[model samples]
Target: MKFLTHTSIAFILLLFASTSYSARIKDIASIQGVRSNQLVGYGLVVGLPGTGEKSSKFTEQAFSTMLRNFGVNIPIGEKLKIKNVAPVAVTAELKAFAKRGQKIDITVSAIGEAKSLRGGELLQTFLKGVDGKIYAIAQGSVVVGGLGAEGADGSKVMINTPTVGRIANGAMVEKEVISPFSQGDTITFNLYESDFTTAKRMADTINNLVGANTATMLDATSVQVLAPRNISQRVSYLSTLENLEFEPARGAAKVIVNSRTGTIVIGQDVKLLPTAITHGGISVTISENKTVDQPNAFAGGKTQVTNNSTITITNEDSRMFTFDTGVSLNDLVRAVNEVGLAPGDLMAILEALKQAGALQGELIII
Candidate 1:
């Protein structure tokens, strides 16, 4: 645990040192209203080999409807035993300014009792946006990366997810989503992680490059900058602005503890106030034994058995440490390493410190 702690801290320090904790505008923020939109629709996947849904009512109804649309009539109340088709949900992302005939990838997921979607083909499906408007048409052969097989005795071997598949360049866009970026006189940059200081620094960086009062900090998350109305000039202007480098403000002091994996991450700014902490452990053990009495067999013509139990307890020597006012991360690490505490023990101590108002950072356990 001590080695792991030291290694994590060293890696963090190396990362900060390598980049000087600076980031480009393109990496930290995004152009507002210039993002991808989600599209979804119900579709069907076919051409499976005895691995499709058998008893799903929705799959049957959908299959019948498709057949009817193709001029085939089926008698009412007749169940079709189709074993090569499965109902699926298709999803895709429509990028901003996507033109007609542009191809995009799509994901197909089984929504029935299908055993596998391998070697299946998705039929022509309409991918609709949130407003229920068709934006693209999807139809392609599914490329499955998972494998699945089932035995007659109900045993099955599966790897990854057998019911989901993807098709690259499967959907062709048929409509363009209107964006407000070209309509407004100013383009807004939205920070991925909002910080007031970072916003001010970003605005200042842009103002220095373009001219004074060119970029205005609208809020902690948004920075509005004036731009040309022409699309070509606007595009060139954004290309230059996004590449500009600036130093983002440091994040707040925080300690994150992953309870499941026993991972503790302490930020560089995390400090400890004046306090004392002691940690120890106690363990208990119990054992059971059985014995037989032979004297009862001779006197009463019967033998009896009795049960016995043993209990033991052990405790380790308690270790205590004190922290002065405004102790830094290095000092805390040194003290914890000297005390030989495991990750779980360290987590307990951190929680105790937070409760006692001695930790000068937010302690988050996940």
Candidate 2:
């Protein structure tokens, strides 16, 4: 009786529970008329810790070329020995509706063979558009990702990846990105995650708020809306439409397994069919301890090598547990894990189950 009650309560919660929270239309989709433009620039990173590019002629030649364009004449073949300069590539996105003077964040990556970018300063870098026009400039102290430490014997330790860094609000826009919403009578809203149910619900929500026939779902990917004929009114109309709230559709059922980290994440929609699974593995660890043999005074024994070795082989080949006729996803995972199956074992088992048509959901391995 207690088991039946608990199962009934859990099943009810699963049906009534919200899979997703409410989000504004702008959060789930984008205004077809307005979008952010991608902007990338090639520039230089300077003030690196003595590990900048070496005395390669191309590095010096590139630096001299840029300097000459800045109206500095240091002769064509002068040996410029700048040890702190490192070439870099800077890139950023000029967001949609970004004004002429607004600031956007930029990411600076080391393109050269610089060992580290800690405490480096970016030079005056121009971010150009695809049309070869300068739109913004980036120059700031980089924020490296990790810390580097070295032991007394020159052994080093580092975490994450310090090779790349970011600059918050680093680039200031000089030219405004062209996003004009004054021409079109209809605008299409593109959902980042396409779902027919969510798309229909969104269209219905918009039409209910602004009366019938205001918004129509063109297909599962886009929803078309009729804006006011006037430019100012159209802008205001679209702004209101982008703020309406509705719940998004549930994503596709999938089981994502990370082999490197032994992590498994199963979506709510994931399911399992009635199937028996048997998986086993073995872990053998070999360890060695070295010992030096001492020679007795009168004996003819020199220094000899004595190794104390140990080998442990753990084989988990227990009897397979029957899943019965009714096995839920959570139950299947728990049953597999009861035999001390590791993450990779679970991944392999899932792959086999998928191949055998026992796993009803998608299995994605990372």
Per-residue alpha-carbon lDDT of candidate 1 for residues 174-217, written as tens digits (9 for 90 to 100):
98999988987999999999999999999999999999989999
lDDT of 2 by residue, 340-364 (tens): 5655666787888789887778889
TM-score of 1: 0.90
* Whole-model alpha-carbon lDDT for candidate 1: 0.90
lDDT winner: 1
Q: Which residue pairs of candidate 2 clash? A: none
Models, CA RMSD each: 3.1, 8.0
Q: Please list the C-alpha lDDT of all candidates, in the order they appear.
A: 0.90, 0.78
TM-score of each: 0.90, 0.73
Candidate 2 residue spans exceeding 4 A from truth: 1-21, 46-51, 69-71, 118-120, 143-165, 277-327, 330-341
